[model samples]
Target: MSDRRDVWITGIGLVSSLGEGLEAHWTALSTPAKPAVDETTYAPYVLHPLAKIDFDQQIPKRGDQRQMEPWQRIGTYAAGLALDSAGLKGNKEVLATTDMVVAAGGGERDQTVDGAILTDIEKQPNPEVFLSEQLQSNLRPTLFLAQLSNLLAGNISIVHGVTGSSRTFMGEESSGTDAVRIGWSRIAAGTSEIALVGGAYNAERRDMLLLFALKSVALHSPWAPVLADPKGVPTGSAGAFLVLESPEHAMARGAKPIAKLSGVWSERAKRGEPGAIEALVDEMIRTAKGDVSEGTAILSAACGAPEPTSAEVAAISRSGLPVRSVTDRVGHSLEAQMPVALALAALAVSKGKLFAPLEGETLEEAFEGTLTRAIVTGVGHWRGEGVALVERVD
Candidate 1:
């Protein structure tokens, strides 16, 4: 009865290392290929860099573009694409009421300032005092203001005029899972007629790479698919956003659905505890709506962390469904991880066919037939696990 309201996915905006738009992804993935990676630049670490994009196409103002960080620009561009795809970009009536939910991390670091401070620290006898003084003198007044995570939502409101209520979530991968889940729940509950939900990540930062590498969570070169690696995730630069609306609203607007989102469930597992992740994933899957027996494939957001990946693989094996890790192709996008997978699911269901398997055997069963449903699973590198069941509209 709760799911009777029927939440529909009407528009999706996606940009990744593979490329942008639904067609680019589908075309590349349909072929047997490996993920695009940069082995020498990061040296010893692999990264999936974003494809070239003309920012002026989506973000017209150079001033607005200059003020925001790369991640914000990526998110703003993707948001514009989503609104355009949903036929709501310039519809002031609809834009005025369309809610926005963004999942994002803290802003990128000011590496030059950081470097200057570190360089100056060693020259002072009282390093603590020097550190404080340098931060005060060198950092720009606007630097701190620019780092707020909610700026993504604010920029979206300003750029696209999506002036409805806005919200932002901060936890890594789980943040993305909850963004979509909350959007769908609000739409289905009739509290919101329509919403834009998703996130983005900029992996081309020295600070980011170092931060992740410190945790030993960055994949080294001589790259391998997510499931194949036991070391860490190969992070990528990507932005994904989706337009979700109630079935009634979509029909009233004459906007056809790309897929139907039945339900989503999420949980955080206490790591280092055996069986914790397995049990968490199993429960999330069981709680989701739609017929599990009809699932065509599991689009896994397994972030290639040794512990979580192994446990996710085990849990999904029990579902007896073919599984393909999105990280295998695009690498992990942290907060954008789940949203990207959800977008991929919508694309797959709309086509009514599954893409060729990246890791064939476990997910190798050929379905030379129409596809109707896909189960999306997101297992965080360290903490969360989420599952969603999506069905074809036709």
Candidate 2:
């Protein structure tokens, strides 16, 4: 670790319920208003759907546009934004060598087929046979192929001409933590020069909603901050990506970095291990190389799920740094959570301030001065916990 080069966040591509890109999100966040959440669309379970996206802006070809599922499209679009932000878009020479690591969930479910089978279940004497028959007949091979998580990385390469070493991770929230971690590790170690990393998640599917409900974790009340939520984690749709490159690589091309990705550490502890998360947070702090200072702020990826959130709150409290949860503004996005928090932290540090609190969360404190460093935390709703440090290069 001592012989490594500095890793910088040269570009960020992020889209969530709040807005698109850094400027739009920063503006919305800084405004003194309640977090924008939809309680009626999904009823009891809240959702933060993405703002309208003009697909043509990123995915240009009509045929190419039609092939990708919603999540793939979202990731592809955000990847383009990150490439553009890093001043690498359409630069064939630079892109030819850019590495990519993506964290993504499974493809969208064929809901119509699933619903028809369910409704016809009682009509058949052998429900299991009928279910099996419908699944085989109704699901197209193309749709089946699209379900592979790596298709997102493939789609980005096909559309954006980023034909480099591409890697995709598929764990829930931890997938996000590892995606950035791996990409940053490569650049810092100088084995590779620059890399694109991040993840995307679509929570709009009935199947996904059902998945959460089966676990009894879906929020069933009005929307509020992660700290204020009386229920549990609500679902949301978001996609985030970042262009991480070695400092030397960036300076050679005159790419001004948004922030430096100083360090990233991830851990998975058993949920059954009571009080394990507090120690996980401490482990993350210890891994950060101890540059935390008065100018540092913490952007929490605290899922509104009760137990984990409570533990994260206590852990962050022990650090005594000013804090805010982007999850408070945007609902919980499983695979995209870590990168989204990192993107927000990069934007906040680049602009030198934290956003205004959405009102009602007592843990939030407005940053008093310019942000020189930030600790981005992710305490997964179910099993994993991680934290990352992004420092101002100047």
Candidate 3:
């Protein structure tokens, strides 16, 4: 650890229900505003739909755009924004070696095909044969290809020209945490100079709704702040990407550091055991909290699931830091949750102040002091736990 180089966040691209771009998110979070939610579309479940986006600005090719699904398009566009923000958009020299780490889930299911198969399969004589036939004939060849989780990274490479090594992690919220951690670790260890890391999720799909419904973790009609609500997670559509580079590399390119990614710690707690999450969160926070005195707060990605949210709340209480839940504003973007929180944390440290409390004054109190450091905490709705430290670059 002592030999590690300082990793810096040189660029951030975030697109969510609040809006697109850094300025838009800052304006929305800093002001008194309600989260943009759609309660009727997937009733009685609620979700935060993506704000209007102009994909043309990022992915200009019509053929390229047509081939990708909504999630891929979102990720590719966000990656472009990060490259632009880092001053590497057209710099083929730099992009050719810019490694990428992506956190992704399988592609959206074809609900029409799924429904038809279900309806007809029940009446067929040989269910196995009928099912096999339906799968081959009903599903398009391109759909299977689109479902590969690594396509997000491949599209980003093709669209943005980031030709370095590519790695994709798939495991909901934990994948997002590891994507950032791996990228940071590689740069700090001197194995890589720069990396692009993040994830994207599209929440407006019946198949996903059903999947979460099976777990009984889907939020319902009466929406509430994440910390206050015990009703499950209300997923959101979002894409977040960060450009991470070593301090020396950034300086050599004249790229300004948005904030310093000092440390990132990740763990998977055995949720079946009581207090596992709380213990891991406590230890991780203490470890990542090294030497910081004042002007610090926490940006938490506590999805509204009962157990994990409760455990995270208890941990945050013990830390005594002014904490705000990212889920309260953006809804729970499973794979993008951690990256989104880190991006906002970095943005806050750079701006020297934390945004206003997301909900009522009780759970999220106002932070009036100058912000020099921000701790981003992510307690997965079910499994993973992670803590990341983002500090001002002096």
RMSD in angstroms, all models? 2.4, 2.2, 2.2
Q: Identify the candidate with maximal TM-score.
A: 3
lDDT per residue as tens, model 1, 1-394: 6445899999999999998889999998898677788888988888899988898988899999998999999999889888888988789998899999999999887888877776888888999888778768886534676678999999999899999899999999999999999998998888999999999999888877877787888889878876655578889999999999998899998999999998888888888788999988877765653355664777888888888988887787777776777887888999999999999989998998888876433544566666788888989887888998888875
Each model's C-alpha lDDT? 0.86, 0.85, 0.89
List, residue by residue over 1-394, the lDDT tens digit for candidate 2: 6998899999999998887899999988988687667778777788888888998999999898788888888889999999988999899999999999999887877778767776889899998898778767895534688788999999999999898899999889999999999999988888899999998888777878877777887877677677655368877788999999988889899988899998898898777878888888866865663755668888888888888888888887778788888787777888889999999999998888877865788888766787888899888888889899998878
Predicted structure 3: lDDT: 0.89
Angstrom error of the Cα, residue 257, model 3: value is: 0.2
lDDT of 2: 0.85
- Which predicted model would earn the best lDDT? 3
Cα deviation in Å at residue 274, candidate 1? 1.2
Clashing pairs in 2: none
- Local error of candidate 3 at 254, Å? 0.7
Candidate 3 or 1, higher TM-score: 3
Number of clashes in every candidate structure? 0, 0, 0
Query: Which residue runs does candidate 3 get wrong by more than 4 Å?
Result: 117-143, 291-293
Give residue 49's error in model 1 in angstroms.
0.7
- lDDT digits (tens) for residues 1-394 of candidate 3: 6999999999999999999989899999998577899999999998999999999999999889998989999899989988888999999999999999999998888888877877888899999999788768886634688888999999999888999999999999999999999999999999999999999999988888887887998998878877765579989999999999999999999999999999888899988899999999988887877667589898888888888988988888788788877888888888899998998899889999889886552578888999999898988887899899999999
Off by over 4 Å in 2: 116-143, 289-291
Q: Candidate 1: where are CA atoms >4 Å away?
A: 115-143, 289-291, 359-365
